[model samples]
Target: MEILMTVIMGEIANRSISFLIDKCSSAPKNQDERLHDLQRLLLRVNVIVEEAEGRDITNKAMLYQLNMLRKEMYRGYFIMDNFRSQANNEEKNSEDGNVSHHFTPSKLNPAKRLFFSTSDNAHGKRELQQSLYNLNNVIVDVSEFKAFLRNYPPLYRQPYSMHLFLDKSMFGRQMEMERILNFLMLPEPSAPPITKRVAVLPIVGVANTGKSTLVAHVCNNERVRNHFGKIVFITENDLKDRGLINLKDRDVVLQPNSPLNGNGQVLAIIEFSEDIDEAAWRSCLACATCLGSVVKIIITSRSEKITRFGTTEALVLNLLPLEAYWYFFKVLTFGSADPKDQPRLESVALDICKSISGSFLNAHIFSSVLRADLSTTHWCMVQATLRGIMTRNACLSYECCVNRKNPVYVRGRVTNDLFAIYPSTEISSDETVPETTLPELLLGGVRCEGKFEVLALKSRIAPYKNYTNTCEMLTPRSTKAKRHQKPR
Candidate 1:
């Protein structure tokens, strides 16, 4: 009976999603001339990007070119979406007897002030000409690319809804994923492999920049699983101790599956959290032999020093540019609801994204808040608090501090040694989250008197990791004592 009921509910959900997709897809495309042109340009670029993602793009120059095209595609969309939103805002304001069609500096939210500095009216013919020229040059360079794109089959069918796509997709990572996979399934390639003495691939990025997530997806691929006899994950602790040397005895062997293919070949993934030591790296390579004949060693680290350990060129990851991140954040914030319909909310959401400092985790958490309560007042309140928090830190991001494994203040308060803090983390599906969430704490006036865990973030993307943090509360006497310790 329960199984029947569950099946019925799931079917209903599927039908509902399909109906919405049909409606959105059938809706009229942008009628405005400039938007129509931009949309067509973006569509062509999308075709190229989508095609490239499917094939094994080993050429570094080609990968770089593909990346440049992606940047321009994103920029084009950013311009299109903002233009659409502004037009909507103007029409609404004109109807409401506020026909000035101008947003004053004072009227703009903190986010708008940070990101949208140029006057909407200032986007003259000269600027338009320059943007078109840049975009055209990219498309023109990739002209041969389009002809070749048809030869390689696509990786996956395109999704109908942006909502569903963003939910399951790894944002802005298609090219990188293809490259990593190409490196992993090597030597028998249509392309070249790394040098013979056990290939090494190093991936470097700062804290919380999708390094783990990217590698996790690559390692889980069926091709990778079938190619190696054993796939082992080694952490900083594993390398520091004699963990990897005695593999089976260690507890942190992250993902262990039966050797599907008895090739007796091993692939080792080392999370080098600190600067790489040449002697220690050599020792790691030595330990790799004990597991099996090492096929490849993928080392991921926050330190650039890891590049020295790679047999091939290292893959370095960086955060998205301001405009690109805004595009991503905007999509996440406004799901089915059209941003054009709620101009006020759009302003607030933009500011909130600005304050987040490109933290993907924060994007998940705050977008949930916006989704939970889709009110302009609620959004404004959250934005004000978020902006205040950023201001108090002198714009040193809470995300960066958390990513660096440092304790950071989440609110505006001047304090000393005995102050409070929230130490954040990203948890997997098997783990449990606390009853209290970071959004409630920051926006809903939720408070607790002692140390307790709070859900800081929950990603909708694959692996669907959730983030939590420990909230430290101080007693009145302790707080007073700390404040008095400092002489003004």
Candidate 2:
């Protein structure tokens, strides 16, 4: 996923460079210089990132910096593309206008030409320059990271499959699952009435810790199936009222054809992304409350903040124990947890499992990398790389290890020792306001505004890659200034 993201950004930069070169003749004198500088900087950074793609990037901060640079580059690319497009349209319209329309007399205004004049895109030029300058700084930071990684040479690196096969029971959280079931099944004593029988149950955890898989298990439980006659699993795209039921202020009346229309108990399994419309979600909750039958909601998200949406306390999923992780790793790698069953590979399997911090994804990938070879020498080499990555930061938890490439995730809310990474900012003055005001929609600082444009570019540039369709990152550039238009 990370490699694909960088490649998409590079493709955008490549297209933007071509666009700038083709249109430089009509652009402002200063615009071409900035564009060329940006093109050069992006090309250089692209080369560096591609070189490091196959190498293990163990540091979380360095990986974050690389992603930030990609984002800034994408923003720059779109800004340039938009400006070029506007310039082309303006020129086209000028040529197609009425021939005799309001020609300025040369004697009255000597500097005036007979043709229409285009406004100087000075604001866009400046912003373009600023974005390039910021991106250059990010490149410098990434260069420092490259230097740091140079000290640790690349180990036995292999292309690993993204898919993983594992037993759900061995992934931990049995006790937590039981707790969630109790919360969903048991009726509250202090509850107001049947009309207000709705309850929100949010399952919060970090990425790749099997949060989705765990939710799937609970949703498929036999008891849960019996309790709620009407079960609807909705994703971000299915939130519209047309396909589903319309939600009004007072009551939520389901459509006759709607699956949730009946008076039987209803269970909604909503997969919440950070960018979902808050008003729509609130309306859904209100509609549930208005529904005559008992309604239960199970929301799965990486954000701990979602817990506040539920009237009852949210359930937090913790990391699996070392024993559970071993079992998971053994089954995934050797098809069984018993080392005695596989006498030849037992020692090497234990060595690899111990080095891993209990991430099933990591184990899956590493196992593939070492799958062809059962020799002790090759196993020891792979184990050494894993240990080195882990020991780089002695105090590292599995979260940090997984976070290196795992993307943004949610943890517990702030306590005495722990503070929020993005603490709510105080709006003391208008000057203190950020340039972009929309709530963050993408996890791991990804912007979503021009996601379609980026993906469109990616598909056109490199359609041969099978996973292009799977790489869904939409975080887009900050709001741009309105385009300048000529008066009629």
Candidate 3:
């Protein structure tokens, strides 16, 4: 009796000690300390996401929370990584005897403010605080996530590094993919099956924001293919007032062999560059009904008006945040090579990314150029060229299509002449492309006269689209002639 009583007293004492320790630790940590915790939490969340990616999760609520978690993870990672990059850059600048980065505000000491300026330091603090608050709220909202996570079995670990993952899979769209896949695979049984009121999903986003790629990826999924019999692509050019009846010759058929397991319904993929009206969408659906129970209709457009047409809620995709884009671009640029090994090159790579804005095609193209030659000299040249291009028109890199807002001109290195440039239409895998790639042109190894196409980087993923810009060689706009012109 005495020993049992002693043990109970000891247990109470231990619990009390533990409780106090937990309370003290939980009491607001310092900024740097809190960031360390945030990093660990984000890594934990990343592992969970990687596991979740391989499995098909159906809980809409869970899926939504996962999206929030992934986004916060990216934000947290960005903050931490940016600080590290700044610190290293400061150290590198010191070693190279370089005065300092062209940090804004001249009154500040260049040596003292290596990592950040007064404004930057204050701004960074606020950003970190807001990030922590937002992440905490997301975690609190999804308190039961861990409990649900236990139910799903883990798949074999995928050996995908950041760069490899970016190369193979769609970056920043895993949750979106899962959401769409679940929608297609398991139709809502609550709706009468006989009516065959087929589901329509409208994917809306800005131009070149992967709206089309997402639809194509979901359509090509094995599970989705097994659920629907026929897959057809209908472009803005293919739509007729009569609806989808005459698509036999018009639309491209993706899958012909019936999987024998599916419900034997057609899956129509419609793509539009402009806003599609209510009547046109309904007509497509009406024609779909005439075709005997089209199970799914997937449409993608840049206009948000398409959202009204979805039977389910619309999925909107935007480009990654600047920090996230930098992280991705850095990985792609260094690829298998460590950024630590070449800090100067890494700094230059950031400039190149900014010059191109958020253009994914340009990201791939320039990253390829950087990776091809890891030397700082080559990277610097690329940076200067991109800067020159931006000086002409920055938006040129943003859009893959030819209808650019401002004309782009590339000056001949030797001839000192300017040539007008325009991007060509999408080139497919089987189609013939120009011999001179975009990198070749920027490198200035070869210069040709007259109009010709320069092949930009091609997609390694589905849709396999490539960009080729047309360069119209022209007589140099004679600055000498302007100099001699008399005042009007």
Candidate 4:
């Protein structure tokens, strides 16, 4: 039985070591499950050790095993510790917790402090075992040992994932964003009180138009960050499933007075796709308006028609200008400003800019694909590819305008009548017209009196085989003798 118990204890120790190694191998985010698994392995080891007759392992051996575990686990702990330290520093700079000092290290127990410190040497493990041995003989409470393990640095790393998600200082976007805090803070109109307090601004454009990028930038801007008391970003799935229900549970309600009711004014920035149904869109809009009378809900979408559904106060961002295009080009090329490459590439870039027509996303993507090649031959090839895309875009634009199911009319006049000759076709604005004299051509059509002229009846008449048939069609059922006029 003694031999069997010793074998079992050794097996448990080996298994515990294996478990610790596995936990160290994975990411810090998965530390919760790893911690639980480690605890279970340790419990098995403790059970087997207690059952063994002559297998009373020395505290030195246990400490040696712990040292091995610490070395293996230190990498993950170091990464998490560094992240936490940096996060805390940022929080302190922002005065987030109203704390004065920023560089404070977390207070930890002796074992954890030793385990985490980079200065701890191999001999320190033996010293720690000796200290524990001396403390164990005293009539002290045994609960302290459990508390020490429970408060270890490894346990601290277990909650790192939650911290990562909740850390607002870590969230950011790459582009520059404009803030309208001053505009929103303007006092309510005094004269005829405008009841429409809530406003929704839906940004619409085609795919790769930088909608999300713009939203992200605007949300992370310093002005917006400082002005709003509370800002929350809700994903599409969350909006659909809960419809701001979770937000309400968090005490974030959609009410105008509530904005001022809390600590200060709160602005909730809700982002959703254009694909959301009209009802869901309405729900999101309602939520925004509920937040405050001066609530500004900014939405990004690929459809132009989303403006008609909710609030009419929508602003469309014009596509990138030439200056912005150059800025974006420089960014994509990583500041490779060679004029030799520019002359050949400028025309192609212009054509691409015109084709994409101000979409930052498109420009960025196209530039990224081309920037991979450093050779002049690749630039030439890119020019060729851009020309093809331009041609295709022109064709698509024409098709979209011509083949629309319900064509738009202007002042009760059918506009499609002019383009009925060719369906889904477009003529360039630069095309020249054929030379022809209007009166001469019409006069040569038919003769009247002494001069060559066409009857007024023929000019205004409906479709007919010839001028005579046209005249007959217009010579109406009215018997009143209307004077017939002819060309002089």
Question: Which model scores highest in lDDT?
Answer: 3
TM-scores of all candidate predictions against the true structure = 0.74, 0.41, 0.77, 0.36
Q: All models: lDDT? A: 0.68, 0.51, 0.69, 0.39
Tens digits of per-residue lDDT, candidate 2, 291-335, equal 445778888776787887877788876666554455456556655
CA lDDT of 271 in candidate 1? 83
Model 4 lDDT tens row, 1-488: 99999999999999999999988975443322332333344344333322221122223333344333322222222222223333333433445555533333334432232233322334543433333333333213323333334332331223333222212211111111222333334444433334435555566655434455556545554455555555655557676577644444444433333343453345555545445677776666666555544555666665667777545455454444443444345334433354323433543444444455444334444565456665656655555554543342324342243223322111101111110111111112244322321111221232122212221111111111111101111122221232242111
By lDDT rank, best first, the candidates go 3, 1, 2, 4
Question: How well does candidate 3 score on lDDT at residue 100?
Answer: 59
Q: Which 10-residue window of candidate 4 scores lowest in summed lDDT?
A: 412-421
Compared with the true structure, the alpha-carbon lDDT of candidate 1 equals 0.68
Task: Give the runs in model 3 whose Cα sits over 4 Å from its true position.
Answer: 1-45, 88-120, 129-147, 153-158, 186-198, 239-245, 250-262, 276-287, 307-309, 394-405, 412-417, 477-488
Error of 4 at 292 (Å): 7.1
Stretches of candidate 4 off by over 4 Å are 1-179, 187-199, 249-264, 275-278, 285-295, 308-312, 321-327, 334-336, 340-342, 345-356, 387-488
Over the stretch 77-129, how does candidate 3's per-residue lDDT look in tens digits?
66765555465566566667878554532224332342343225667767777
Cα distance off (Å), candidate 1, residue 377: 1.9
Clashing pairs in 2: 447-474, 447-475, 447-476, 448-474, 448-475, 448-476, 449-476
Clashes found in each candidate (C-alpha, N, C closer than 3 A)? 1, 7, 0, 7
